[model samples]
Target: MDENNNLTEPNDSQRNFILAIYILFALSVVFTSVTSAVGAILAYRKRDDVRGTIYETHIAYLLRTFIIALIGIILGIILSAIGFGLIIIVLVEIWYLFRVVVGIVKFAKKQPVTPTGYFM
Candidate 1:
């Protein structure tokens, strides 16, 4: 019984580390560059841990999202010449946001987030 209780209680550092990851994820959307950079650093530093894999996945997601956004921008510019720019941009942003949110949630929960529905 005592052993069980001890097992359930995380030490201070572990608790703080878990909270830090959550906070970093929460701030990622608003301050992506900084938050993601910090996440990447932490991920590299803790490469042997399970949490490190999550952070690494997150970093990959961030980079891919930016690449997708760039593609959207270029497409938007080309489409604007044909008068469908606004619609395409809106759709792309929505898609990008969805991928980021879903991927992060799945990572946090230790589930596999498959690339699907235009995510490549």
Candidate 2:
């Protein structure tokens, strides 16, 4: 809830949409950016809908996660020229999976996650 007393728990439609976004991010592991890209876009589209609710943090969290992952991937590619970029890329994927799983758990419990902080 916010200063206006909005519902903290997500409604049915919002719940489904939020979970779907998380799932999309998770699927990025196999799709390799395609799914996460779609998820990020969807999250941005939904950002205003949850404005004053706890779900707003969820959207920001997802966006932050996407940005960090993208950065890590780019850095990995750049460093790959030195033969160690694969390690950073792999770690970023694992981190992305971990964050998504944590986000899903938080969503299930109606818990608020860090919206701007890195590493969840």
Candidate 3:
């Protein structure tokens, strides 16, 4: 409550950021890798602004997801030369999609992500 005893609502910027992240993730699933990179960059840029807030966990979750997906895809490509990379690539893609969908669902429900581990 402010001096007027009115309840102060949360700012819209946080919600905007969350929605942007979800859109970017969905784009990544439908389009190319560029969207994922953009999302990761946005998360990094906004990390400080959300620090010490609940949104910070979401930011961290996104960063970890992006980095892990990138690394896994690269490794999958390299290992494909050995005939085993095909499996790795498929698994990595599935994992990435699962994380994005789960995150979006949780965010939409206004629920805090439990565990918040490196993985989904």
- Candidate 3 lDDT, tens digit per residue, 1-120? 112223233257986897798789779888998998999899999888765555666677788888888999999999999999989989988888988887888777654453257555
lDDT of each: 0.54, 0.86, 0.76
Displacement of the residue 115 alpha carbon in candidate 1, Å: 5.8
Model 1 CA lDDT for position 104: 57
Best by TM-score: 2
Best by lDDT: 2
Clashes of each: 0, 0, 0
Q: Put the candidates in lDDT order, highest first.
A: 2, 3, 1
> Residue 13 lDDT in model 1?
54
| Candidate 1 per-residue lDDT over residues 11-117, each given as its tens digit | 45543453465456456556664564464456456533433333334444544555666688679878998899988877876776676667656655644434323
TM-score of each: 0.50, 0.89, 0.85
**lDDT score, candidate 3:** 0.76
What tens digits encode model 2's per-residue C-alpha lDDT throughout 19-111?
A: 899989988887768999999999999899877677888899999999999999999999999999999999998998889988999998887
